[model samples]
Target: MSRVSRDGGQVLPFYAAMMACLLFAALAFVAVGMAGATRSDAQGAADAAALAAAREVRDNAFKGTDLLILTPEEWEEIIRGRRFHTAGACAQANAFAGTNDATAECAFDVPEFTVSVTTNGTVGDSVIPGTENMHARARATALIEPRCFLQPATTPPPPGGGGVVGIECRDGTVIIVNPSDPGPLYKLARKLFVVRLTD
Candidate 1:
């Protein structure tokens, strides 16, 4: 009778090694996929925030002006409500294509809101050339809101009451002010407005 060979045990180690290699490869692939997905999500969020900020500027801030005028506190308030942390406001004075116009650039003095959100998941990097590490930026711009007038006074005249006077009434007209010239009311009304994001 032939004796059983002791070398049979070697087959078991070979199979085990192969299994381990396959498992490691699978894990590596999964890790790569997860990183890619996170980057995509961050990009989408950044784009949305930028666009929303711009819309706010257009709808409420830039009216009949060459640039958007927002105080540091006001800018922070608007950005914070939109889920963005603002740093400060600044004036962009560089001469560049498409951005040479004052209206094309935004100034940020703050550290947080002025910073850019990168695909690498870092926030607060300036988009400016020499100020790259100084601030972050989100730009929004549009024409002025439309215009509508309040109704004329309707209060009755004293004594003889010849005509209406001092009778304040809300105008039914919905004034659509041009995005360029929002006028004085723009500043006041913008304070009450908030920005919301959608999927």
Candidate 2:
């Protein structure tokens, strides 16, 4: 047996310090990752909420209006993105935000729908102080653009009667709406509008 070297105890302290550094680095990385995930969640909620609101407005544009009596000028106005109902749009935004575990505040300005969201989750138990209660927030806007145009009929209808007309879409799809049967046109309201998320 021999006496222990003095360097043995010195190496122990060095190893202990190295382990502490590594632990701290790992905790820091975790904190950063948690914060990033929270931010992403908030952004996703905002985008979905905005898009949902826009889609709701676009879908309801044809509601409460008699499609059979739509004049050429009225059709033009609708296809020009100047007509749409915004009723119940903000409700849709809030519903979507709830689905994504967030809360939304929505605003509408013509064809644009803006939504802001705060994530339900926080960056919990992070290395940084007070980050455990930090919640992420984000905002998004969506637009509803009309993709179809009306091709007015050459011949006018009889008195108090609606005639057949063609709706030409940007995708080269032509929809013929007949006064006898306007069901198909009513169902294709989604094709008439293009809803998308924006900056």
Candidate 3:
């Protein structure tokens, strides 16, 4: 056989294989990045849904304030408030999910005022095969906690019995005054609550 240089041709297959691997590596990196983005999007949706669902309690709480006085039993309920409706709260969650281009599967833990929402939104057009079917999902739970805390009157006065004096020491600021304050009774009965995501 003639001593023909085969160096260039010999490296061609090796270089081609390396190029293919590099291409695949790049593709894999892109796919992972896309999947991460999808997951983040899903998480955002789930968080929003949970919060919106929990806020369903807020409107009802505000409505509950319409009553001039929250009786002992009613006040007890506010302390252990159970105001959210499953269907209405889920509706809020679904609407929030739709805004984020996701669908929500929501569950309300009544009495606890916790809303758990799972968001399902696919990350589209993944470069890797089979990854297109990846459905990004995330679960988030939110809680509604009341802000008002009052110690019941210890001693009942004679005749008309008694009424709330005031809720003392809000952050060390004694919220003094009798029940005469327009806002105090309103604040007590229809207290605005705070919503926070636990997971």
lDDT of each: 0.35, 0.83, 0.62
Better of 2 and 3 by TM-score: 2
Candidate 1 residue-wise lDDT at 23: 86
Candidate 1 weakest ten by summed lDDT: 88-97
Writing each residue's lDDT as its tens digit, candidate 2 over 1-199 gives: 3347777877899999999999999999999998999999999999999999998888777778665666667767867878788899999999999999999999889799999999888889967899979999999999998888876544323335567767888889887766556675435678788888879
Best by lDDT: 2
Q: Candidate 1 clash total? A: 33
- State in Å the error of residue 191, model 3: 5.5
True lDDT of residue 17, candidate 1: 96
The segments of candidate 2 whose C-alpha lies over 4 angstroms from its true place after superposition are: 1-4, 152-159, 184-186
- Model 3 residue-pair collision total: 0
Model 1: residue 162 alpha-carbon error in angstroms: 27
Q: How big is the positional error of residue 130 in model 3, measured in Å on the Cα after superposition?
A: 1.6
- State which candidate, 1 or 3, has the greater lDDT: 3
Considering TM-score, where higher is better, how would the candidates rank from best to worst? Answer: 2, 3, 1
- Residue pair clashes in candidate 3: none
Q: Can you write out model 1's per-residue Cα lDDT over 66-128, one digit (the tens) per residue?
A: 213433343233323332222212211111111311122333322112212333232232322
* C-alpha RMSD of each candidate structure in angstroms: 14.4, 2.4, 4.2
Q: What is the lDDT of residue 18 in candidate 3?
A: 100
